[model samples]
Target: MGKGDKKSKRGKIINGTYGTRRKRKIKRKPSIEEKINVEKKK
Candidate 1:
């Protein structure tokens, strides 16, 4: 049960694109420490 799975609204003035504006779900770059830990895990 998620947004992408939902059907688009009919006859809407402004259609949502990628749902980025509605929610800031963009992924930020990982810190230097985090990158090192991830590499160690592998």
Candidate 2:
């Protein structure tokens, strides 16, 4: 069981997603340079 499972112990499921949010970890954090580049293209 994961964090979501523990929270929804009553068998209730979290909406708007296929999985739980609490268990989801950040895969990456883009650098400041990347952010600026995206804006410049627009």
Candidate 3:
């Protein structure tokens, strides 16, 4: 196999794994109960 082919294969694997990790880091908006609880704490 050529060096270029090896690099492309590694790049594909890295890209696929990185995408799922990125999605997991995304924050969802708080629910109404969560918002109220936060205000109560303050």
Candidate 4:
């Protein structure tokens, strides 16, 4: 279970792929300042 193992995080990264072993980053919500600007534009 090392870099050659597809089920491991290191293996996922080496393979340039994502799976249960390597989760993709989630999108963050807009910050308070950004939210205010969006409201002003409306």
Candidate 5:
């Protein structure tokens, strides 16, 4: 329930770590339309 608790989100954040309670953000790929636009610009 606190910083010492590894299973809690607050604890994960305080420890600067990721776990079941704190999932890392996923990087999104550019959409097909965006890629086409970039190619057109080039």
Candidate 6:
């Protein structure tokens, strides 16, 4: 294949321009008692 064709194929994977979409989620922190116990150990 030509150099331009090779570049286009690489761009598809690296750019992720056609990937699936999913909801973003983050983990919640521990409670107050959990925090206090961790601090006490130190």
Question: lDDT values of the candidates?
Answer: 0.54, 0.56, 0.57, 0.93, 0.93, 0.55
Query: Which digits, one per residue and each the tens of the lDDT, describe model 2 over residues 1-42?
Result: 543564453322433233352355569988999999999999
- Top candidate (TM-score): 5
Candidate 4 per-residue C-alpha lDDT over 14-37 given as tens digits, one digit per residue, 9 for 90 to 100: 999999978999999999999999
In model 3, the Cα lDDT at residue 42 comes to: 100
Per residue, candidate 3 scores C-alpha lDDT tens digits across 1-42 of: 233332454454555543432344568899999999999999
How many residue pairs clash in model 2? 0
**Alpha carbon deviation, residue 3, candidate 2 (Å):** 19
Count clashing residue pairs per candidate. Answer: 0, 0, 0, 0, 0, 0
Better of 5 and 6 by lDDT: 5
Candidate 1 per-residue C-alpha lDDT over 1-42 given as tens digits, one digit per residue, 9 for 90 to 100: 244443333212134543423454669999999999999999
**Candidate 1 segments whose C-alpha is farther than 4 A from its true place:** 1-26
Q: What is the lDDT of residue 1 in candidate 6?
A: 30
* lDDT by residue (tens digit), candidate 6, 1-42: 333332454454455443233223559899999999999999
In order of appearance, the predictions have TM-scores of 0.38, 0.37, 0.38, 0.59, 0.69, 0.38
User: Ranking under lDDT, best-scoring first?
Assistant: 4, 5, 3, 2, 6, 1
Q: What is the lDDT of residue 30 in candidate 4?
A: 100
State the lDDT at 23 in candidate 2: 53
With a 3 Å backbone cut-off (N, CA, C), the pairs that clash in candidate 3 are none
Error of 2 at 25 (Å): 7.0
Pick by TM-score: 2 or 5, better one:
5
Predict model 6's lDDT versus the native: 0.55
Give the least accurate 10-residue stretch of model 6, judged by summed lDDT: 15-24
Error of 3 at 32 (Å): 0.2
Q: In candidate 1, what residue range of length 10 has the lowest lDDT sum?
A: 5-14
Q: Which is the winner by TM-score between candidate 4 and candidate 6? A: 4
